[model samples]
Target chain A: MVDVVGSASSLHYAITGRPNCSLSAAGTCCVFLSIATITLIVAFGFFLAGAWVVLPFAGAELGALFWSLRYVCLHAGDYERLTIDHDKVLVEHHTTKQDVRFELNGYWARVILDCQPNGYCRRLALRSHGKEIEFGRFLSSEERLNVGRLLKSRLGGYLS
Target chain B: MATTIPIQDVHNEHHADNHPDHHPTGWMRWVMSTNHKDIGTLYLWFSFGMFLFAGALAMLIRAELFQPGLQFFQPNVFNQLTTMHGLIMIFGAIMPAFVGFANWQIPLMIGAPDMAFPRLNNWSFWLLPMAGLLLIGAFFVPGGAMAGGWTMYPPLFIQGGPSYDMTIFAIHIMGISSIMGSINIITTILNMRAPGMTLMKMPMFVWTWLITAFLLISAMPVLASAVTMLLMDRHFGTSFFNAAGGGDPVMYQHIFWFFGHPEVYIMILPAFGILSTIIPTFSRKPLFGYRSMVYATVVLASLAFIVWAHHMFTVGMPIASQLFFMYATMLIAVPTGVKVFNWTATMWKGSISFETPMLFAIAVVCLFTIGGFSGLVLAIVPVDIQLQDTYYVVAHFHYVLFSGAAMSIMGGIYYWLPKWTGHMYDERLGKIHFWLTAIAFNVTFFPMHFLGLAGMPRRIPDYALQFANFNMIVSLGAFVLGASQLLFLYTVIKCIRSGAVAGNRPWEGAETLEWTLPSPPPYHSFETAPVIK
Candidate 1:
């Protein structure tokens, strides 16, 4: 009974995995766009209230600069994930049991992202305990080679 | 899933083997206790004893003023009663009660097993009783007890008899106690919260205490310096507040009010926190705008330091300075207003019930607002010139202190009595005590405002016949109010000894990790830390 229920959930995960990347990206973009739009509206409202065209224009320009500065400071990370489970595409950042769980599916896939040199990384990259994997290696050219070599050695047998 | 870490569980197992047997019982346990809770109980009982003693002195003052002809005590004795009453109540009674509350509650609230420095807590509490003994003992000295009032404003204080010396000594001891107590409180609160209980997450009672302790550490030394100068002038022939020595009496007033103004808030802000806690519990609501309430307390504490000179406006400070102080004093109302609004908003649209604790909490809200409004009127430069040193000032502070701090202390006692005693108090006796005291308090103080507006100066043994009838009524009400406290004393004791057994969570509307433990909690509560979700 437990095996049947587990396999059914795994099937559901495999079907929903790959498309989640676009959903997350769209959500982030919407939030950023809304905040930027609000800043523009408030700046214009202030200008109209003051009834000084030049003064309000200068103020709005300053406001826009501040808005962009904060936006970059908050969310400079630019990486995306492509996950698979149950010998099929699973929910991105999601997984199921018994499908070579630690196997990295995406490779040399222009994973643009920010990386803090001294930042903490998660232990056991996907819980197979083969070795510690540096997950954000896609952020740099040299890191891509190091990560790809490690992944090939660990997951080559599991891949199709 | 929310993780449950029973930190107390670990502590109990670790400390169980180390627990002492053959622990000493009886009076020696009290005298030699290094435990925070035991010392806290000592401080509380000592404060209550002083409260009754000072209340007696107040009755004497009222009795002498009853018929306006120096009927009961002589003029000198009347002055002595007035002076000692204020001194005893401010330093001996109210301040000690607050320190007692801090000692008892702060450790339990913060989930610390005990005060950071238990020995220092014991020493500080012990000094209080010693100081009280010396001060009270001064009545039997070569001359009567000091008659220079609590401020002990120089010239008069220096000229008084040997009791003056005794009073100064007692003040020094009390100052040491307060400074030590404040330091201990500050250290404990800063150093001892459970993990995940960040500064913002701390209860308001703890926050107000943090500010009050800071006020004490900063201003208390200045007060000690001022009193030292007074002591020198009295004994060493140095003139700090003497005109002959080229020192000004007004300088004494400046130093006194610098300590006195924040001292008033120190007495009352804890009451504000207590009311904040009790009102929301009874109303069945999360305290509205918790962050704003925190900010408002900080603002009020910062403003308290700057507005000291408002107390000395009539002492002929520069007109500009007077105006500055006046406006600054009035600005206090803004932060104070935010607190009141937050409390009222917390109770809005909630399932409100009037328990004994709630009744006192509500009375505190209404009566303290009246006091705050009168304080606003007194803050006006022109009006203060008229009202300063009058019975109006007297009426103003009684509302603030008695109905404000004292009411909340009673409420806190009732609110936590079940947890402390493992039994519930008789509700009927508590309600009767509340109503009688509230009505009698207003009756005693309200007429003083009219008397002051009619130009009656305070601290006088005699008054004109025109103010006679109201004075008589106020005096009668004073006796009744004094008598009403017996009900509270009786109810507290009866509950402590034998009342209905209470469960772990006595109040259905209560929230707080403290409620998640057994009643009268074990000798050690929460041996293991409880995880905050």
Candidate 2:
């Protein structure tokens, strides 16, 4: 397997060429629960100290915070992957809820990076025989360009 | 297109992260949304509603003061109205409206897909209504809301009834919400800029917000501490502000002014940002003194800390401390003068357009300067001793807050309404609203300057006969001003419901990344981070 991983120093999204994710494997639900627990416990302590009015507002605030964290956790495992072999190139998209895969014949696949007039990268789309698929929507512009160049070299042999 | 292979397959099992397909529709969408745009809309509408609510209280105040001598409300009730009016306008209306602007514009301007903490953004906004509920709820409680003024100074505040506790709780809740919002703003600005978009390259609105966020983070906590001490004195038998129990009430003023002075900047800095944004766009030129504008904003924010004592100049400090504060407060005019000059220079010799937003921007520059000059006059210790708590102080702040902050908010709404709703507001109606607001506002406030100079104390239900004519004119003007805003409401609703569609780049001179997107931006904006050059 040819593996490529995003460095920790960059934007927090970590991408690995292998099937396994480098993201923290800690359960997302557990993270929110701990945060809520801590917040409520501290707030309850204030309530015990005679600031009784703080309890309900604290609950309301932490409840909102918990809901927000849950959304982040639900989307934490999201990523897109591309695989190339002698005969086919496959694209897989994985979310916390589901996985999707697309298969294309290696000989007819094309990679394109449509850039603005200012030479800034816009989007990365792959086209083949009347079908098109776009990915790398989450990556930065420079990263999208890098990914486009990598895909092009990997799929070079089948050009007419 | 380079052809290297052939492909034919489709899958919907796992959609992309920011795809609009999964956005929750209807009421739950608002309650649980982590999206910045949705939350921004909520903040803006809520604040506008609060503005009207608070403004109604102000109209009643003017009505009571119309003929002087207890016309509408008893003294205590009048106290409640004035206190609630100040609190609601400062915390409820102006602050959140700016936060709303921050929410809608920051991510789009910076090329970030969403705020650094999307969920935190949602939480911060929702807390506002909860806090507002607590405050509004205080009116129904016994003793009918805390009447110790919005400043909540002690001894009197400690003596208030049950509503005082509720107000304290409300303040605490709002302060926490502000801190969360400031954290989100600071984090997003520091960490989420697109490649090549350095701090200096960031939009002026973003820079102003960056500094404002720091102000909120630092100053809000002082307020929290001050209020907490007040709460303790009220409930826990602590003597933080009770002189009879061995505490000094003046210490509370020191702490409160420390927060209060910076809070003034917190309200105006964003207006400065809004004006900076609109002026250059309409002038059709790059802002003059971009680096100096940034430096000037920092200088003003820094000076804000040292000048807290100027507000309490009549509170009897040592002459040395008094002189230090007076000079420091006066020194702020230097940076402020730099900003005003820079804005004028930007407009000079440039292709300037007089759109609705531009008109409001120009009005803010003129009226806010009048307020600032009055502020300089008040900064001198002797003059402040005379004008302090007089209608002149009232007039000065109304010019600053109403004509300055509120007017800029109107400008921002006009400038960005096309981008937000994808429709052009009726310009004729906009101009009419502007004229009505301007005329009525001056008639309402300009007389107050004379009333103050003639020695009329504020926050009182009764005054001598000499101030009656101006009071009547101000009341008449207040009624007209209040009614004129109906035009603003009608204009906004008309534009949102049915108006000409706005194409991308509604304004010809607009230059931000937000202008590069669709007129009504998609639910997921900037899904792929933009590279700013």
* Chain B TM-score (each prediction, in order): 0.95, 0.97
- Per prediction, fnat is 0.00, 0.15
| lDDT string, candidate 1, B1-533, tens digits | 22222212212112213322223469988888877767777887898889999999999898888886868877788888988988898889888888877877777777655665677788888888888998899888876888877788878887889888778788878987887787577656655565566778778888888778766655565566567778778888877678898877887787677678889988988888888889888999988888998888878877876798888787788888998999999999998899899999999998999989999999999999999999999999999999989999999999999999988888988988888789999999999999998899999999999999998999899999999999999999999999988888999999999999989888888886667767886555543344456
lDDT value, residue A59 of candidate 1? 40
What DockQ score does model 2 reach against the true complex?
0.12
lDDT of 2 by residue, A6-28 (tens): 43232222243321111132543
Best model per TM-score: 2
Each prediction's whole-model lDDT (CA)? 0.71, 0.82
TM-score per candidate, in order? Answer: 0.75, 0.82
| Residue B447, candidate 2: alpha-carbon lDDT | 91
Evaluated at residue B351, the lDDT of candidate 2 is 99
Per-residue CA lDDT of model 1 for A1-160, tens digit only, reads 0011122233322211111011123543553354345434533443353312223333433353344334333332322242334342211222222122223333221221222254312111221222222233122223333333333343323221
Candidate whose DockQ is highest: 2
